[model samples]
Target: MQQFAGNSCSRQEMDELMQYVREAENDQLLHSALQQQWSSLQPEEPLYPVNWEGMYDTIVASPATENKVGLSPSPIPLIRRRWWAVAAILLVAAGGIWVWTKTPQQKTPPVIAAAKDIQPGSSGAVLTLADGSKVVLDSAANGNIATQANASITKRDGVISYGGKAPGVAANAPVGQPLMNTLTTPRGRQYKLVLPDGTTAWLNAASSIEYPVSFTGKERNVSVTGEVYFEVAAKSNAPFVVTTPQQQVTVLGTSFNMNAYTNESIARTTLLQGSVLVKIRNSQLKQSSYILEPGQQATGNAGGMLQVRDVHAEQFIAWTKGYFLFDHASVPDVMRQLERWYDIEVSYAGAVPQREFGGKLERNLPLSAVLKMLETSKVHCKVEGRHLTVLP
Candidate 1:
């Protein structure tokens, strides 16, 4: 039996044989071969045999065997042929580890060959006015654009801002025709804009913001689809409000971040300064509200349930500061952020093992480098042009 176990019985072949042994009926020839392999296993010290009684109990209780294999056979005489057969099978199964490691292993295929070339976020956006005019705001743009009512729209130092007062309009002007302004950044892009109402906003890559030309009436409101960092202007009389499909965040004056991307079901509102009230949509007449203090975050789901927790404000707002800081984040969450920034596709061949990764990666690093860092944790990744696939 030992002579028959030649080079032809590769690790792969042995694995298949062991799997077959688990399900197939026991025979004398197969049983003798397994016993020969098991007898060869010798530890440096006297190794006690495994507690098969306890192992058998666990196997019997397992859900997979509950409906199929049923309970273990009644304990038989120690010298019976059936008892020896079961012991040999268990011993052979335990020796599989030694065989696999002792044999030559196959070479794995390479995944990402080179790292992607990406730069730090910069000043970039595509602005569209109510008059159907498009303006690309970046470092190259010379000066301020046309003034709107009481504010002078200006671009300086790679940022867009509004100054001066409405020339002839009343202190409280009506919310004129809805004017849409969108701020977007590519993989290596970042931007900052000061709204007409003195509200300053910073945008991360692949993000956008839409707002009216001016705020009129009792409340100041804006709608966002992606991520944005807001340092809202203080106005006790006019509260600032941010609205998304899942919920709304209202504040008197505060600095916070709203991550309500369409692809993510959970809308997160992380407060950096002051306070804000998060209102979640529910079936009841009164929506659930959560008040957040500085260094707190309110995560609201589409189902209208909400949770408030403490978080590091700087880490939550790291994207606005030109970096992707992860503290034990999941692979899927990390990949989701990468997908939006790089504008690429991602898929997985098998289950992504649950791993907690902690590191601070510059946003400017190439996509390939990011994937390489992930591989350090035993996770493999393959990059085919713009598509990235994760494999176990």
Candidate 2:
């Protein structure tokens, strides 16, 4: 991907950075050296007699801050901080032998042409009409696509909307098949849908949601595979129900997120508003259900009791806002998400590294940038062709 670090740094920005370096007790001093070394001060940074020539000179000229530490002889000022820094300095000063061994292969640019192959996923999905006709939404010009007796299906602005005449018959007619359509997203895509009942759904990558073209009965029901976030429209007479292969979630016009990826062992339903009844379908014991309040989640497999827990709903919904939020998430778990959105395969050269990460990254960044950030956590990555290899 394109590695971009501006060549210019403003005076105020540089001063603020100098303050950060001075106040980090020199802990973040060398940590930030790479950036300081790579970036040049803008004409406005007051780089005069010494010309802001070297990062050391800049540090030497910087005013001592509250977190300043006393230091001795050192080429890189930061090596004077912790015991590890002392060892680093001793190794470097011993003959500078170890310095060359830890080369920066991780931050180097990827094969640009090959790197260009990995771009962010966009809004898209395959909308199947009641008759089994499919519409490639991204390629289909935004407008009306299909019309049924009770509703008209329209695609506009990456969203599919159902609007038309009122319901004629219940979608859950037990006598015959209901007229339903499926919205599906492949590995590298996601989509949004507005149900005939005015319920909104945000489908994540490699996910699908099947529902009637129009709600006819006493309840609005839909079945989801993979992951989907729902904003159910409240109808006092009709409760909304979402079913998955492993579990079923009943909600009363509340907003919630349901993650039922087939690859995962547990299906999780997180509620943001309104209460939800989570029922386990795989349980061999007595039929049981768990009522979840706002900011709560229910997770379990088909054969186990659904466990209720508290969670930060924002983290679960960040994907809908274009982010990859990981809270103590494993490397493989992160790779799985990356694989889905970047549309690439991931392989391991050695034993999988046991690491947990906590942070947030924009989903729109190129594969290389994400890998570069991952490398900081000691997870080395190399992208070639359409595959990414994680090295131990």
lDDT of each: 0.63, 0.68
Candidate 2 matches the true fold with a TM-score of 0.71
lDDT (10s digit) by residue, model 2, range 202-278: 99999999998778777788999999999988898999989999898987879999999987768899999998899
| Candidate 1, number of clashes | 5
Give each model a TM-score: 0.65, 0.71
Candidate 1 lDDT by residue in tens digits, 245-323 = 7778999999999888777768899999999999885524344678999999888765667888888778878887666
After superposing candidate 2 on the true structure, give the runs of residues whose Cα lies further than 4 Å from its correct spot.
1-117, 166-176
Q: How many residue pairs collide in each prediction? A: 5, 2
Off by over 4 Å in 1: 1-121, 146-151, 167-180, 186-188, 282-287
Q: What's the lDDT of the predicted structure labeled candidate 2?
A: 0.68
